[model samples]
Target: MTNEASRPAVDLYSDTVSRPSAAMRQAMAEAEVGNEQAMEDPTVNLLCERVAALLGTEAAMFLPSGTMCNEIAYRVWVDRGEEIILEESAHALHFEAGGPAALAGAMVRTLKGRCGIFDAAELETVIRAPRGHHGQRQKLV
Candidate 1:
C-alpha cells in the first residue's frame, strides 16, 4: 500500500528560488560597482578573498553560479580532452545539469557513494591514468 499524501518530500531544487530581501536589494543598489572581469569590483574581490581565506585555498574567483565556478575550475585544472573524478551524486554531476561536459569538454568518472560522500577506497578505484584501456586522466575538482 502506498501512502502518497504521507510521504515526506524533500526540496532538493535550485537555490535560485530564494528571493533577496528588500534590505539585500537596497544594499546591492548602494554597493560600489566596478568591472568584475578585471577584478576591479571591490565587493567581488573582497568576497573572493574572504571566501578563499576561509576555505584555505590559494585564491578564489567570484562567479554568478556554482555551475560556472565548478565548470571554470574544471577547465582551468584540465585541458580540453581531460577528465574529472567526483562522487556519483555530487552537485557538479547531477545539479549542474551537464555544465561540466558542456563547458569544460571533459569526461566525468563518477564513483559510487552515499548521499555525496565517497570512501577513499572508492576514490582510489577511479583515480587512474587514462590509457589504452582507460581515457584521458587530468584533474580532480
Candidate 2:
C-alpha cells in the first residue's frame, strides 16, 4: 500500500492548485481595486452589473467564496428552527460541519440517494407533516 509520503504533492482538498496566468496577474496589477462591501469599487460594481444583466436580474453581489454563498443563501431562505432537505452526501451536510445549524439555526434531513441526487417522491417521504409546533419545519431544499 502507498503511504501518505508517496502521494503526489498536489493538494486535492481545496481549489488552490491553479496559479494566475501572466495576463491575469498583469490585469489584476493594473485593475482598480476597491472596497467591495461599501460598493465603491468600480471593478466590483461593473462585475455585479454585468452578471445582473446577463441573468436578467436587477442586481447581484459578488461573494468571495462558495461557502459564503451557501451560508448566505441558507440564512436568507431558511428560517430559524427550520430544516433543509437534502441528499446524504451533500457538501453542506459533510463539509460545512454544522454551519447550517450554528449559523442559520437550521437542521438537515438527509435522504438516501445516488451521487447526492434524489427524487421528488423520496423527498416527500421524509417531509415532516405540519403538526403545529411539535417538530422542526422543513423549509428549504
Candidate 3:
C-alpha cells in the first residue's frame, strides 16, 4: 500500500474534495435545467427513474447524499424505541450523525466484526434477547 506521504494528494474527507473535470463541466453547461424543489427537474427525475428500475423497485427518490439516503431509509424502516442490528463499523451506525436515534427514534444493536464483515453465527448471537424485559429488541432494518 502507498504511504500517505507517497500517495497522490486528494481530499477524502468529503465529496467536495475533488474539482469537477472539464467534460463534466461542459455536460452540465449543456444539460437541460429545471426546478428540482418543484419536482420538475429532468435530471433528477431521470436519476430517480433509472435507479428504481435498476434496483427492481417500483418507486424511487433522489436524496442529496448517502447520509440523507440512509437517514430516509432509517426513518421508514424503524419505529419508536425499536433497534436495528448493524455491523459496529457500518456507515449507517458510525457516519450518519446519530440519525437512527435522533431522526428515526430508534436504537442500535451494534455487532462487532473483523474487517467490516460478520459471520452468520455472530449475527445470530447478537440478535438474541438480553435475558430480561428491559433489553432492546433487535430488527433487521
Candidate 4:
C-alpha cells in the first residue's frame, strides 16, 4: 500500500478567492472604462467584437456575468408564463433565487439526472407542445 499527498500550484475552486497577478492588476488600474449599458465601454465593445469575429458571428453581446446572460436569454427565448426545462441541479435553478420565475416570468421544470446530466430521451419526455389558451408553452431548455 502507498499513500501520497499532492499540493496544487493554483486553486480554481472559486473565483471569490482568486487573486490577480501584478500585471493583471496594473491593466485593470489603467483600463479605460465607460458605461456598458449604452455600449459606450470600449473595452467591452472590443471584447464583444473579438468574440464575434472568433465565432464567425455578425455581432455579440458582452454581459457582465452568467446570471445576466441567463436572464437575458430566458427573456428573449421564452415568453411570460412559458416553461423552461432544466436539470434540478442547474445553477439558475438552484442558485439564482427563482430568476426564471421572477425576472423572466418563466415556469421552471426540473429534471433529476445523475451529476446534472440527462439524456436526450429524458428531455424528449418533458417537451410539451403549445396548447394555446390551455397550458403554458414549453419553449426553452
- Superposed Cα RMSD, model 2: 5.3
| lDDT for each residue of candidate 4 in 1-141, tens digit (9 for 90 to 100) | 533346356754335657899999999889899998998989888999999999999999987667888999999999999899998788788878889999999999988777568999888878766788979988887
List per-prediction Cα lDDT, in the order shown.
0.78, 0.85, 0.78, 0.85
> Model 2, 15-112: lDDT tens per residue?
56557789999998999978888988999999999999999999999998767788999999999999898899887888887889988899889998
Candidates in order, TM-scores: namely 0.67, 0.78, 0.76, 0.78
Which candidate, 1 or 2, would have the higher TM-score against the true structure?
2
Q: Which run of 10 residues does model 2 get worst, by summed lDDT?
A: 10-19
Worst 10 residues of 1 by lDDT: 6-15
TM-score of predicted model 4?
Answer: 0.78
Which is the better candidate, 1 or 3, if ranked by TM-score?
A: 3
lDDT of 4 at 79: 95
* lDDT agreement of model 1 with the native: 0.78
How does model 2 score by TM-score? Answer: 0.78
Sorted by TM-score (best first), the order is 2, 4, 3, 1
Q: Model 3: what TM-score? A: 0.76
For residue 124, model 3's alpha carbon misses the true position, in angstroms, by: 1.5
Q: Which stretches of model 2 miss by more than 4 angstroms?
A: 1-14, 17-20
lDDT of 3 by residue, 39-75 (tens): 8999888888999999999978877787887777777
